[model samples]
Target: MTAPVFLVDAAALAAATVGGVVRLDGDEGQHAATVHRLTAGESITLTDGEGRGVHGEVVEVGKGWLDVRVHELVLEPEPALQLVLVQALAKGGRDEQAVEAAVELGVDTVIAWQADRSISRWRGDKAERGVRKWTNVVTSAMKQSRRLRRPTVEFAGSTTDLATRLRTVDAVLLLHEEAEVGIGAARFPQAGTVGVVVGPEGGISPEEVAALAHVGAQPVRLGPHVLRSSTAGPVGLTVLASRTRWTT
Candidate 1:
């Protein structure tokens, strides 16, 4: 089995060298020490969630912390092509589900979209809480997937705001049911960001689609049948990953 991963402080990990003892504390440490019951001489992996990973063996364990003696340090290279997921807010917890799945599928960044037809609104304190919730989801998914880097989660924004932000991306593919081309055939940038837009349960508005298209986002379909708001982004990401990340 692959070694379980725990997140560590980036600065501390960077300063650590082979044979150095790195401490794991706080929530992650508690889980590692008490929950996982990691004992001395057990193999483990620690990451700063920014591409650096430390492979080590547990040297000591306490009530809520464990120390690992580092043996190897790896810095994963950033993807030549980045995948960004723009997921519209949906009712229930579907949007959160999409974010989790997208992160596991190697999405580089996730932008929450507050679409015009969205039933669940991220208003006032709920807006801040929503972003925090997605951030937590991304962290958990990263560890669950054993990923070296944690994908970023952005605050929820309006359709207009999303369009304005996506204008700077190398390429954007808007997942629309009426789109003529499949995502497989869509053109992706050679070495830049590729944004994938997935609408809410009510779907993307025509005006919103036009707005994204005006910013150079190509309308594309995932498949012949429609998918749920929670399913679309991950499916699109999987297709992109197969053609890009997985191939390499």
Candidate 2:
């Protein structure tokens, strides 16, 4: 089995490699030592969460610390094409679950979309809390999924704001059940990010679709069956990923 991976700083990993010792302290250390019950001589992997990784074995285990002997340090290059999921905020915390799984499925970035049909609203202090909550979710998912590259979670503001940002993306696909074109027909770029938009439970408003379409966002269908807001993004991303370098 592949060793369990923990996130560390790139510079710290670099310095530790020279010394041949990578230290794990703080909450992370406590978790590894106490919660995971990790013992000395067990193998573990450390990642910078930016594609850099180190494979090592625990040399010493303390009450709240661990020293690992570095064997190899590698830096993985970014994918030729990145996938970003634009998810509409939904109730019952399903949006977080979607992004969490999307990160596992190789989504490079996640943008929270506040659509007209969105049930949950983020404003004032609540906005900051929401971001933090999602950040925690994605972070945990990164480890759970054994992903080297940590996926980002950012609020996209209002739908109009998100629509305006579509101009900068290589391709924007809005998953609409009513659309005639399927995801297989999406016009992907040679390079850059492919943004996939998933609407809330109530679905995307026609006016909102028109607004996004005016800004080069294509309304595409997932399939004959309509999926939940949480399920749509991951399913759409799988199609997008398969069509791109993710399969290659």
List model 1 lDDT by residue over 156-222, tens digit each: 5688889889977899999999999999999987689999999989989999988888999999998
Consecutive 10-residue window with the lowest summed lDDT within model 2: 10-19
Q: What's the TM for model 1?
A: 0.97
Q: Show how many residue pairs clash in every candidate, following the order shown.
A: 0, 0
TM-score of each: 0.97, 0.96
Which residue pairs does candidate 2 place in steric collision?
none
What lDDT is reached at residue 2 by model 2? 75
Instruction: For candidate 2, write residues 1-248 as lDDT tens digits.
Output: 87887887677776866339988877778888889888988988888788888889999999988988898877778987888899999999899889988988888888888888898999888888888888888888888887788888889779888987777888899899989899998888857888999999999998999999998888899889999887999999888878776655
